[model samples]
Target: MDLIACHDCDLLYHQPSIAEGRKLRCPRCGAVLLQHRHDCVERCLMLVLAALILFTVANAYPLLSLDLQGREQDTLLITGVIELYRQNQAGLAVLVLCVSILLPLIKLLSQLYVLLPLYFGWRGWRLPVAMRIVDILHPWAMMEVYMLGILVAIVKLASLASIVPDAALYAFAALIMVMAATDASLEPHDIWERLSKTR
Candidate 1:
């Protein structure tokens, strides 16, 4: 029997061999401890690809357009950061840039670096280390939080100006859902075991 520690209750229990597409719960707290997602790598990779395309659209096109008294203004993801800096909110600009842009990009790139080679059965350099680093950076990828903030801002700005939803806004919304699914589908323990065998 494999010993597993419950993250919620900190109770150690003998982990049972769970089949694919099944979940293992902690006996003491009844908390879901492990989920074996079959074909986790393939599913995660597909979601990541969708996210990447959406991410590009989210950055390339205007997020929202503002029409105020015959004047028009549009903003993309990076444009917001620049606007903040231009308005002398340097700290806020940095925060948005890091959480919304930099960290998420790093997470996606690293996942691709690790997963692509593994999927194709090719040996890649430093894949294990890259995967570890990606895990560390995951928490910092606050795309969902940033999306929530944007929604709130849109609500607040609606009364001030005519807020027009753009293609990027829809793309960003889809990206959030895809990213969430990717997180749910990815089984880190299984990934590590598979990676070790390939070495």
Candidate 2:
């Protein structure tokens, strides 16, 4: 038997075997204690794969093209980071790179590493560590915020030059949505239960 504590009311209860599409709630405060989503692992795995493909496309293509004075220039996702560094804004460059690029990549890869093996009924190597990393990096992956900043910059620069959204911009937008779906579909309690059983 397992035990769970209510986060809102500090009420303790025995964890029950909840069926898929079901939720366990705290009796006193009515706070949600646990939820069992149907086919969460499989759904999350597919979403993660899609997110990875989109990530690749987002990084490879130009996010936007600028045309001014009969000259055109293309900018990839990393282009802004590079420009920031060139402008001697090293701290801002690193912050953007970490929050927008590195953290998201790490979180996706870590989810893949953990979920892929678990889906196949095998325990992934260093499963706990990978899952921990995923939880830790969740808040730090700020792709949507970065996308907002890009949009703001585009609006500000519209009067100076013609700005055309590129393949990477669309891909990045899709990636953000897909990543959010993946997070929503993931059931951490189910994952931990599977991990414990496989050990």
Candidate 3:
């Protein structure tokens, strides 16, 4: 087993298996040691599916609707990103889209692809190292950050009009919940162990 010492604090963590990826984490500072997720792969997979459903609602439905001056306006999360791009903040728009929308989707899909088959006793063991890439991407996906931003925007907009939260907003919040649960539950080593055993 490979061991990694935490850079922030003096603690050591074991690599999930082979020296394939970076150390999964540093237990002391909660930094990335390597890319493996949590060990409860099956549980996390279910959460991923739930998150995907929430993600659909988050993107497809209007996030908020406002009525002011006898007019009503509604905006979806992606619409806000598009508006940002039109305002010449393409980088910021892309960042929002990727972090809030794309990353969550990728995480859900990646987790699903690996977990569903394994639960069904399929060829989960045969999947190559691409799952490692999913692990690598997990840390960067910040749905909470986006959620905070959304809350701030909602608060700011409230004083200006009759702001009514939409289905997507609720869905996004649920998505955040599910994603967090999945992140907490899915562990790479456990999945690998199960997969390896099946082989």
Candidate 4:
């Protein structure tokens, strides 16, 4: 048996060696104390790989096309940031770059670093550090928030112009969902246990 404290209510409980894909809830607050994600590391690794591919596609292709006054304008992920910088919105540009691109990339890479080695029976050089980085960067990965803003923009612009969602937008949208699923399916405790066992 293991002694676990609920992060929400601070209630301590005795936890048994639960099976995979199971969850333990806090009896006092009804918060999830622990969960077993059934092959969480492998699933997270695959999802990370898929998210990376989609991230590439999202950045490579045009997010949307704007047809205004018989002229068409295409915009990629970086294009918006560059344009913002060019227009003297440097602060906003940097913010967008950090939350939308840099943080997500870092989170994905860190997860890969931690998972790939564990998957192949090899220990990562700094697994704990990599895992720590992932935890720190998780809240900063705002691709989904960016996607939501884009959708809101589309709704607002629909009344005035022809806004066509492009391949990159779809890729980004899917990337958001995949990343979310990856985070949900990931069990950090399980990873830590496996890392301890392997070492």
lDDT of 1 by residue, 1-199 (tens): 7788999999987888998888898888888888887687888888888889999999899999999887999878888789899999999999999999988888988888888987888888988998997889978989888889899999998988999999999998998888888877878877887798889
Find the 10 residues in a row with the least total lDDT in model 4: 15-24
**What TM-score does each of the candidates earn?**
0.92, 0.95, 0.77, 0.94
RMSD of each: 1.7, 1.3, 5.7, 1.4
Model 3 C-alpha lDDT per residue in residues 24-71, reported as the tens digit of each score: 566567876445434366567678878888888888899888898779
Of 3 and 4, which scores higher on TM-score? 4
Lowest summed-lDDT stretch of 10 residues in model 2? Answer: 32-41
Clashes of 3: 11
The TM-score of candidate 4 is 0.94
For each candidate in the order shown, give its overall lDDT on alpha carbons. Answer: 0.87, 0.93, 0.75, 0.90
Best by lDDT: 2
Q: Which portions of model 3 miss their true places by more than 4 Å? A: 1-39, 124-128
The Cα error of candidate 4 at residue 169, in Å, is: 0.5
Candidate 3 TM-score over all chains jointly: 0.77
Tens digits of per-residue lDDT for model 2 on 138-170? 999999999999999999999999999999999
Better of 2 and 3 by lDDT: 2
Q: What is the TM-score of candidate 2? A: 0.95
lDDT for model 3 comes to 0.75
- Model 1 compared with the native: what TM-score? 0.92
